[model samples]
Target chain A: MPSITVKNLSISFPLYHENTRSLRKMTHLFISGRLRQDQHKKILVQSLRDINFTLRQGDKVGLIGQNGAGKTTLLRTMTGIYEPVVGHIRVEGSISTLLDPNAGMNFGLTGRENIYLKCSINGYSKKQTQEIAESVADFSELGAYLDLPVRTYSSGMQLRLGFGLATAIAPQILMMDEWFLTGDAGFIQKATKRIENMVQNSQILVISTHSAETIAKWCNRVLWLDQGFLKMDGTPEEVLPIYLNKPYEEIVKKD
Target chain B: MSDHDPTIVKEPVIDLRSVSLSQNVKLALTDLFQGLIQWRLGWKLALLDIKLRYRGSILGPFWITIIMGAKISTIGILYAYLLHLDLQHYFTYVAISVVLWTYVNGMVNDSCLIFTSSSQLILSQRLPYSIYVWRNVFCNILILLHNLLVIIVVFTIFRIVPYTLYFLLPAAILWLVNSLALGIIFGILGTRFKDIPPIVAGVMQSLFFITPIIWKVSSLHFNSNYVLLNPLYPLFEIVRSPILGENVSASIWIAAIGYSLFLWIAALFIFSKTRFRIPYWM
Candidate 1:
């Protein structure tokens, strides 16, 4: 029953200049009629343009795009981090996002304490938190390291902790960025297994990455974005060649 | 990321255009209500804020008490001698006033950075915006509790007992409400306007001298009616007079309540209009 319906969604960020961000200058300009003139022509960076899509149960969607092509913006919008500018996104399930590994981390606290903090933020019960701690401790394999401050953790160790915590509870809809996959090979393998298991139980999965092989192996559908527009939307067989500018067989074999 | 109960099927209709003024008000109220419900989380975050700030220190949060005590004793003695006031009574008066002023100063100064300081957690997930405000309120309250030790010691040493100690409850409640209002108003403005934090700090510095904290209002030799116009006067008087066992006039209570109501109205207006844009500003 989990689904996401995005309707003509467009998001733009108002680019605040140095003077515009200052209240003193803003009030001064207002009195001089310059603020009104500036208001008529404000600068905005269009992060996402008129776009429409619907994701439902059993859908495994891959978002393929270059840097600043709005893949991350789209994911952020779906997860309710950024509001839409032109249209709406109606979400019908709980969402879990793996957008940033260091998002909620307090580096001064021990890793175990951070786990408790995050669980509390998410409104988990005491019993559920204990279970999550055990799962994260087991999955991350950072036995004694869990007692140390997270600031002392290596990048790979931090990734392990973030990944394990994010994946501890199986969500109805999972949205992930490409950075989650960057780590040691063994960790990657373990992470892939964990994601695969969650995807199997989850209603929908949306991943943004530049890896065509990853799309070929995992996604049932592909959304190729170029310069803030959805350039193509179809199966990997139909869209991969058009997006990668190569034969479908070549991209599939590359996996 | 925010996690929810999968069993409860809550459909979120994310439409910014559809968020009318009334809807914005509702959202603002819900945000405050939900935040109050999550008081435990706020308390925990506040405790950690105090703990991590003084981590590895010998006395931990007691440093707040020591620092306040030193300031009070130094200022109390020096100012009493300069003003040629009675030593014992003036010292006690300054002690209570300084402690209350520290709480007020800390709340106002910290309110500006409440949202901006937690930009990391704000951007990562969705929670009631008031939770951040409550976190700030709780942190200041924790610091106030630490500073209270100094006042307790001062009272015991002087053998001074406040007769109207019960009045402190309503005064503390008023402070809590005002702190929350300040948090929401300044929290939003500080995030949108880069100049607000410094402006707030500068204004607070001047107010500390203008308000009757170190100096008594009775010594001014002018109509205290003009002094009553200063909003902070009543706020300070309501708390300080009670602890000093002075009678709190009904007019002082009225002014404190009036200022609180004004603050909440401003806070609601600003928060409802701009709460959704906070993350984007970050």
Candidate 2:
């Protein structure tokens, strides 16, 4: 069986009418004037609809889409971050998601402390985390400032600590969402090696990124999503061309 | 491509049959235990939060005590004269009540926003949500400590000593339980309904008048049965009774403990179920 199976997944979000007068009319009359008030106004855009796919062990899938094409939403649903409005997802392994790399660091906490906190958050025991702390500190190259509060660190420094902490513990299934870009040049080189290492060992790797080069470099298979639908799914060589060749007008013309 | 071809390198192997969200609870509980073990870690963060607020200030946290003292004394004196209650008793009532009330108010207000305010942490790492809740609670405890300075000063000025420190056992337990229950409930509700925090703030402000924090609970001519109708009345009594040297009712203590337990279970159930969805909502 595939490591992850997603069948007919869908999500819908309700949009409230924007007109002040229409809102007043609806409230006073106990009716929905959404349709009658302004037919021209766009309302209730469907964020994700009828998404279907399967991910197996040894699959390195890259997600590509225009903004609001449900890339992040799909990742979130797959990771059990968002409950699907419809359909079911079955996963067979321990998943570690790097949806946002800095999710657990307390700004008031020192970088060294934040590392332990992040490790504990990632399900590491105190002794195990303590053992790995030195390596994470060395990789981050934060030096003595590891004892300083995270709020004091520059954005690059923060990302260094965050990235170092997350990658230290290997997970079965790894998920990343457009946060692969390491801010500093030296850290970027280190992070690239880490990603390569993770991709080699991970059962299923799902990455959502806007960078075509990134998708080309890291993924064997690519999925192209447009307006909540999977427009294309194939090897990188087969799908990247169609996505890159699309005219902006044609892409936007669909209602 | 040949076996030696770089394009066809062997895929890395990883175990895929063992991970499941069913273990989310187990992991969360484990994380909770780990946090308890590292309780000192949370206090360090809590202290940092407190210190950041007072950084560069001359009086530091003492200003909090001074301000609370000024507010309590003014209200205590004014209410005593208006209600014709003895100034000593009225001041005691206001001092203890305000200190306790601040704790209640602080927890309720901050609990709802804990997840939202800690968005950075929630998104980046897989930390247990309870850590954020506990951190906020610890911060409130610190504030409660600072506010207690006002209580000490007021009691000294009035020369009102407690009959026994044993009264504090019930009072402290009740206050802690009450705050914890509120924290859990508000923490879950605030995550679910974005509007709950504002609504709670409004309700708490309104309940301030009805709970007899400023006025004596005895001053009300209402029957004892009516006291049971007010949820906050029992909580206030828990704190106020000890300090005022009034008779602490067993019935009220039982009800408060039962209510706290119920709220704790309900909050835990709801929070555990919905915590996974918070990232989506955000």
Model 1 per-residue lDDT tens digits across residues A48-89? 778889998999999988887889889988888786647877
Name the top DockQ candidate: 1
TM-score of each: 0.93, 0.75
True interface contacts reproduced by each model, as a fraction? 0.52, 0.18
lDDT of 1 by residue, B222-270 (tens): 8887878889999988888877878889999999999989999999999
Which numbered prediction scores highest in lDDT against the true structure? 1
* Candidate 2: stretches off by over 4 Å: A14-45, A182-187, A245-255, B1-48, B55-63, B77-84, B125-131, B149-177, B188-199, B221-227, B254-277
- Candidate 2 global TM-score: 0.75
What's the count of clashing pairs in each model shown? 0, 8
Cα lDDT, all candidates: 0.85, 0.72
- Which residue ranges in model 1 land beyond 4 Å of their true spot? A18-40, B1-17
- Worst lDDT run of 10 residues, candidate 2 chain B, spans B10-19
Chain A (alone) TM-scores for all candidate structures: 0.90, 0.82
Worst 10 residues of 1 chain A by lDDT: A29-38
